[model samples]
Target chain A: MIRMNKFIKLAIATCIIFSHSSNLYARDKLDIKGFLTIAGYHSSNDNLGFQPHLSSSDVGYKGDDEYLTLSKVGLQLNYQLSTQFELVGQIVAQKEVVVDNSDRIKIATLNYSPTSSLLFRIGRFAPRTYLLSDSRLIGYSNNEVIPNHDFYAQLPLSYVNGADLTYNFGLSDGVGTASIFTGRTEVNINATDGNTLNSKFKNLLGFNLEYQTNNWLYRFGYTQSQLANSWEQVDTAIQFLTLVSQDYPSPLVSWTEGKEFVEAYRVKDKWFRYKTLAVQYDNSIWRVRAEIGDLAADSSNIPKNKNAYVSFSRTFDQFTPFLTLSAIKTSSPRTFSKPDEGLVQFLSAQSNQNLAFGLQQVFQFAETSAYNQKSISLGVRYDFALRQDIKLQFERKHVEAIGSNLWVVKDFSKIKDEYVSLIMFSYDRVF
Target chain B: MNIRILIGLICFVFSSVASAEILVIVNKNNPISSMSKQEIIYIYTGRLMAFSNGEQAQPIDLYDGSQEKATFYKITTGKRLSQINSYWAKLSFTGRLKPPLALETQQAAVEYVVNNANAIAYIDEKYLTDDVKVVFRLDS
Candidate 1:
């Protein structure tokens, strides 16, 4: 992998040098573009904080006032090396509410198209995982302040390091495209407890099929990945459970035994699969988009889930009013049974119940994996000037007690099935 | 009867002024004689990069905020200029395709077509010149 990375870097450098040397007088060969979004949002609840996406840092909008959690700027460059080859790069700058936040390259790829119908790209680029995955960061291209959280929050991954091949052909009255991509990526998610958690995805593979007519687009995709490293917090809890179980063994109840529990929730080397189907229709007046996805994993800790969302919008002159309904539900929920009363009493006699208390905390940690929530949003976008628009949106949500995985909370025990309301305003522009 | 005829005449004039005649043009040396509306739409939208004859195609557009530009897009795509811009923004950032080069006026568009055999552009009928060949026409 290290050698391959070095090779890709060298190839990109070579393309840049060749293009500059050959086209010294052709200034039009290199095109530069940029986009910006300045947004502020406020949530109604103070107990929990809201972030635009899970991959973002934990510091976000709280109840006290509006926060700058949704503002970012990006610049993209497309260098045409030749009729058949081009190099593209993009960088985004935004505030990272956590430690070690800095601007990074979002895309750096060398694209080659030998024929009008076929294309190949190598280097780091956004995989065709969803309809808008490739353009997720460009707020000027999106209708809402953010994508539907229920559907997009589950996968915070944006780009991968590898290559992809695409073939598009005219089918009937529309175009049909088939693509295959493979890469490896690392994801950093700030846990609700303020700890930065990292997961490495190895052997990542995915394929997508799309058919787009003048007014409608349909897509189907499948992606599979394997976990390259163990989750730190989960591992620590499992180890603690095993140590306590050794001192207080429960012969009658196997799950209460540490070894059995650890085996059930172990996620290392496990495979995770994602399948999605989406459709979109747009004309001069009305635009509609809908998508559904299913996520499956080998370990119980990574519970199976199904998520869906539908968005509708109508354009009237320079104003567009939109409505979106989204939901995510756990298909498989894990439950933990406490140790028997006799075992609790025995632990109290030996260790003053501190070990028993630790065991209970471990159970609570396991239950956090299952998430459930639903929300509805209404927004309006006004094109006040050319190539610029301002949007105002309001959202109401209902989160099942432990399903607050999407939000940052210090104490999980205080979470309850509650309603959350949020309001956001943003100005988006492109040049 | 005279009053009704006057009102009808005014409506006809207004409608005529609302939608003007637009023409799709290519260089005179280009072998292609004509193109369909769908093919033109595909080229302008960056879906198809080559002509029917497998020759590379370069599409040009009028700069933003022009009346003729807005009307042309409205008649061809049935979409507002802002929406079309947004769509291109998505495609541009994804690195899939780039939008056509935008000239300042129809005269520049015609000049661009005259210089490049593979270039295609749209202009008002008034800008018609002998240096370019008309491949498609949108009548009011």
Candidate 2:
């Protein structure tokens, strides 16, 4: 696996260098464009740690301190070798909240266009899961400084390493596009104990369909993947549970005493599915959009969630004022289950109590994987210059959960059914 | 002054400001004589980068904050200046498309359109010249 990753990196580097040298000699065919976003926000609570999306767990402001963690810069290079072939690459640098800042390649793809209506891309590319998936990192491309967190926060992966095919056709009086992509990607899972575990997603398959007319756009997308269980923490925790179960007298009375039972409880390879629908209408003066989505996993450990958001904005001269209402609800399959009646009857009262407590802890851990949140955001953007804008936003978010606070970073005890207010300022420009 | 006369003067001033006309032009040698509103929208938004005859099409624009540029996009594409900028910014990074080449002035855009057979541009109707053929018109 490491060798394959290295090979891919080397190939991308070679392509970039060759393209650059050719462009230096030939010129005009190679295009270099970039975007920058500088943003800072303050939250009402300390260590708020509000991750806007699952793939961006390391983003957002940390604590009550105003931070630049959301700020990012990206550079894109496009080398059109010919009308039929092209090389495209983009790199982004950003400071991750509670994590070290890093520069990473967002996309590096070799594109082939057999005709104007069809295209193929092979390499790393941002999955077109949402309306703004490709340009989500470029704040200047969006009307709001940040997309609605409730709807986008559940997506766990941003890019896939594989191939994508897109076809464009005419539908009635509108344009229609259909795209299919399949690939695999590795995800970094951050544990509460300051540990990071690597997990792999295999057999990632997705398709997106879109139709657009003069003033209206509609999109539907579906994706599915197999998530391989590889977190070492899960293994270690199971080991500890087995050791503790040895104190019990009989297998029936002891929790985790049976290998089969333990294996059943262990995290296993599960199918993750996502579906989304989006619609937008713009008429120069007013813009309105709405999106609804569902994410589910076949395993009990993972949570199934539904999210939706609606936004409206109006443009007056150089200023745009926007408002959005978003919400997400999570349901976990790991509901608390009582031990077998026979085991409970045979075990001592103290042992039964201990067994129930252990079961509760295990289920709680699984349930905390998801969050229930709703937020309303209001913002105004000022087009101060060409291709440049500044925005200010205020959001009031309500988090509702039991046994765990999903959005808070630290001191979960301090979190309850509370409203968290956040203020943000951002400036973005493109060149 | 009389109230009726005052209101009439205000209406007249506003009508004149809102009635500015923008003319879309292509090189005189280009085969395309005229284009529909929808076709012009597609070309300006970078969705259709070539003409029906398969000739490469290049769209040019006046400087960013120019009223003519804003009015043209608003009436033709039904998009605000900021929205248009946002749209192009997203496509530019994806390498799927590029925004129109922006010239410093309307005269520069007209001159470039006159020289390039494949180039198309928009300027105030008052700037129309014989060197270029008007393909579409939008009145703000």
* Best of the candidates, DockQ: 1
lDDT of 1 by residue, A137-230 (tens): 7776888988788888778886788888988777888878899999987787766666767778899999999998888989999999988888
- Summarize candidate 2's per-residue lDDT along A388-407 as a digit string, tens digits: 78899999988764422235
Native A-B contact fraction in model 1: 0.44
- On lDDT, the leading prediction is 1
Whose TM-score is greatest here?
1
Q: Single out the weakest 10-residue window by summed lDDT for candidate 1 chain A.
A: A18-27
User: Considering only chain A, what is the TM-score of each predicted structure?
Assistant: 0.85, 0.82
- How high is the lDDT of residue A331 in model 2? 69
DockQ of each: 0.36, 0.32
Instruction: Quote model 1's TM-score.
Output: 0.86
Poorly placed runs, candidate 2 (over 4 Å): A1-27, A55-63, A97-103, A191-195, A237-268, A332-359, A403-408, A412-415, B1-21, B27-31, B48-57, B65-67, B103-119, B123-133
Using all chains and alpha carbons, the TM-scores for the candidates as numbered come to 0.86, 0.80
Error of 1 at A192 (Å): 3.0
